[model samples]
Target: MTDEQQAVCEEVLAGPRSRLPAPLRAWLFRPELARRGQSLGAYARYGTCLAPHLSELAILVTARFWGSEYEWHAHKTEALKAGVPPAAIDAIEADAVPDLEDQQSRCVHDLVRELYASRTLSEESYRRGEAILGRDGMIDLVAIAGYYSFVAMTLNVFDIGVPEGAERPFGRGKARAEAL
Candidate 1:
């Protein structure tokens, strides 16, 4: 790493994240982008107005959309810790709409899925998002999805894997039927 790259690393490590994530490590190849991406990442992951469980749900949706194994493995536990139902996570992993009774969770799931499937939100989707999340929360929700999408793609293109011994979220996992 160049001196500039090392400095970027120091900046990221010194921030709230405290450690470099895999995407940031790859982005460090261009220190400038690393600097900016991490800044956005910090805000998306930490500064969002949405609750942690909602944030984690958005991330999981993004990971599933991209088939990002590393992202899924990393955030699945976080979603649970944030109080997301395991059944919802399992449904997401299985590429099915989760039977989320929570209006907010369902709103987030639909917003993200709409973003990916149509590349834009419909009037009704936007209305529901705004109604449930409000303007600021809606913004934060989109930002979370957008940022994690970038992270997921980075993990996929670089072939980043989950830690050894971690069950792969897709076919290699123990049994989806049980989780579902």
Candidate 2:
């Protein structure tokens, strides 16, 4: 790796987590894009007004919806650690609606699910999201989807894989092929 590449890797490692993620490493091929992408990523995933649990849930849903295995595998643990209910994660893994107690979780799941399906938010969804999250939270929610979608695509294009022996959450299968 070039000195510049090493520098970028170090910068990412210096963040909250120590390990350099596969997606970020893949983005290293284009250092400028990676820097900007990681900056937006930090803000989108961490700077959002939504609770970590909610944001992590939304990210996992996005990963599953798009059948991005690397993304799913990356966030599943974080989502769980951030307090996303196990049942919710299980339901989303199987493409079922989770019986969540939190209104925000349900709202975020609804918003992201619809957004992935239609590439646009419906009026009812917008109103519901706005009511629950307000305008800023709603905007941040959508921004997370858009930004993570970019990240997911980068992973897919690069065929970034989980560490050896790790269980693949969104592996290629009939379900994965049909996701979409």
The numbered model that scores best in TM-score is 1
Work out how many backbone clashes candidate 2 has.
0
Candidate 1 C-alpha lDDT tens digits along 1-180: 899899988988888886788787579888999889989999998899999999999999999999988899989999999999999999999999999989999999999999999999999999989999999999999899889999988877766767668788774443333220
- Whole-model Cα lDDT per candidate? 0.88, 0.83
Which portions of model 2 show Cα errors greater than 4 Å? 173-180
RMSD of 2: 4.0
* Each prediction's TM-score versus the true structure: 0.91, 0.91
Instruction: Give model 2's TM-score versus the native structure.
Output: 0.91
Model 2 clash pairs? Answer: none
What tens-digit string does per-residue lDDT give for candidate 2 at 1-180?
Answer: 888788887787787656766677677888877777777887897788999999998999888887788788889999999999889899999989988898998999999999998989989989999999999999999899999899888777666655557787766632323222
